[model samples]
Target: MQIRLLDLLSRIKRLQEEREILRRNQALELLKTLKKEYEELVEERKKVSQVFTKSRFFKAVELQDLIRLRDSLLEWEKIAEKKLKDGYEELAKIEEELLERHKERRLFERLKEKEMWKQSEEELKRLYRELDELALLIQGQENKR
Candidate 1:
């Protein structure tokens, strides 16, 4: 039963893997998203910094606003890095589970083979016993004749 279930699970997983087209792609996609977000944040910061520069010659903008923007980007970058690391860790765990499933499937297959071999041996022994009995019956009848 486990063998069959494992086989089904593996097939489904393989299909999903094919659809995903390389598990590494997940990580790559994550990196791309993070890069895009970082770039957008940098652009936002640049715009704010530019405003501060322009204000110095014209209106007055607080330096605090620029400082706040830089701090927020730094915080977001740390969070993004953690998420990326977690994503990789999750991938590792999935691979480990797949490996464990393979091991279990192999073990079940070996057990099934052993059981079939035992059944075959018993069947062969029964046939030989039946043949021996027939030979003894014929010999007894010949003596009577």
Candidate 2:
């Protein structure tokens, strides 16, 4: 029963760790994508602004479009930053718990191994004693013969 419980808990911890890892990877990947998109938007906006500056005339419509794009991208980046921060914190917590669970599981496994060794030793001793008795009985019968 104890071993079963330990095994179950170990499996649970491993699963929890796997889930956290996946979440962290996904969060990081999203952040990377957002960064790439933001960079592309900035480059596109810079090119347009430069073109307008050289012409010495601001096209109000184009300027407004650029502003909207920048605003939306910034908003997305803000949200993604928050999500990444939260995910990192959660992953840290899960990792800490995983470390503790691993220690506990290792201790239990060691104790279980020691107990099994003791039982085997006792069984071997019993077998030896039985063999000794059988040998004595055979000797007696041969002497009578």
Candidate 3:
């Protein structure tokens, strides 16, 4: 029964480790995606700025259009920033969960080790008692002889 429990605990530990690895990979992928999006936003902002600078002789309607474009770009930048923040928050939550699973697995492992040690001690004591009884029996035979 103890051996079975130990085996089960080990399996649980391995599963926890695998889960952590998967979460870490997911976090990395999310970070990569966020970085790509940020880079794209930066590139787009730069293009908008270049256009605004190069078109100095804009008519009234053209100027209004440029203003609207700038406002839209600003709104998109805000949205991107919010998305990045949310992604980081999600990663943090996953890391916390992984840490908790690791702690639980370690606790089970410690309990298994303690149980094994106790069983070993009991077996050792039983063997010592058997050896003592055999020795006494041999001494009695010798005395009789």
Number of the predicted model whose lDDT against the real structure is largest: 3
Q: Ten-residue segment with the worst summed lDDT in candidate 2?
A: 1-10
The alpha-carbon deviation from the true structure for residue 117 of candidate 1, after best TM-score superposition, in angstroms, is 1.2
Given candidate 3, what's the lDDT at residue 11? 76
Better structure of 1 and 2 per lDDT: 2
Please name the candidate that would achieve the greatest TM-score relative to the true structure.
3
What does the lDDT come to for candidate 2? 0.69
- Regions of candidate 2 where Cα sits further than 4 Å from its true position: 1-56, 124-145
Query: Candidate 1 on 1-145: residue-level lDDT in tens?
Result: 5545545655665555454445556666876787678677667767776776776653234466567777787788677777767877866766666566556556655666666677789999999999999999999999999
| Model 1 regions lying over 4 Å from their true place | 1-66
Whole-model alpha-carbon lDDT for candidate 3: 0.84
Q: Model 2 — TM-score against the truth? A: 0.55
True-vs-predicted CA distance for residue 58, candidate 1, Å: 9.6
**Each model's Cα RMSD:** 6.0, 4.4, 1.9
Give TM-scores for every candidate, taking all chains together and pairing residue i with residue i.
0.57, 0.55, 0.86
Model 3, C-alpha of 31: deviation from truth (Å):
1.9
Residue-level lDDT of model 3, residues 23-78, one tens digit each, is 87888798888878887877887887898888778899988987888788788888
lDDT of 2 by residue, 1-145 (tens): 6546655665666666666667657666766776666567566656755665777655799768866876676676567666656666766775676577566666666666676677789999999999999999999999999
Q: After aligning candidate 1 to the native by TM-score, how far in Å is the CA of 96 from where it should be?
A: 1.3
lDDT of all predictions: 0.68, 0.69, 0.84
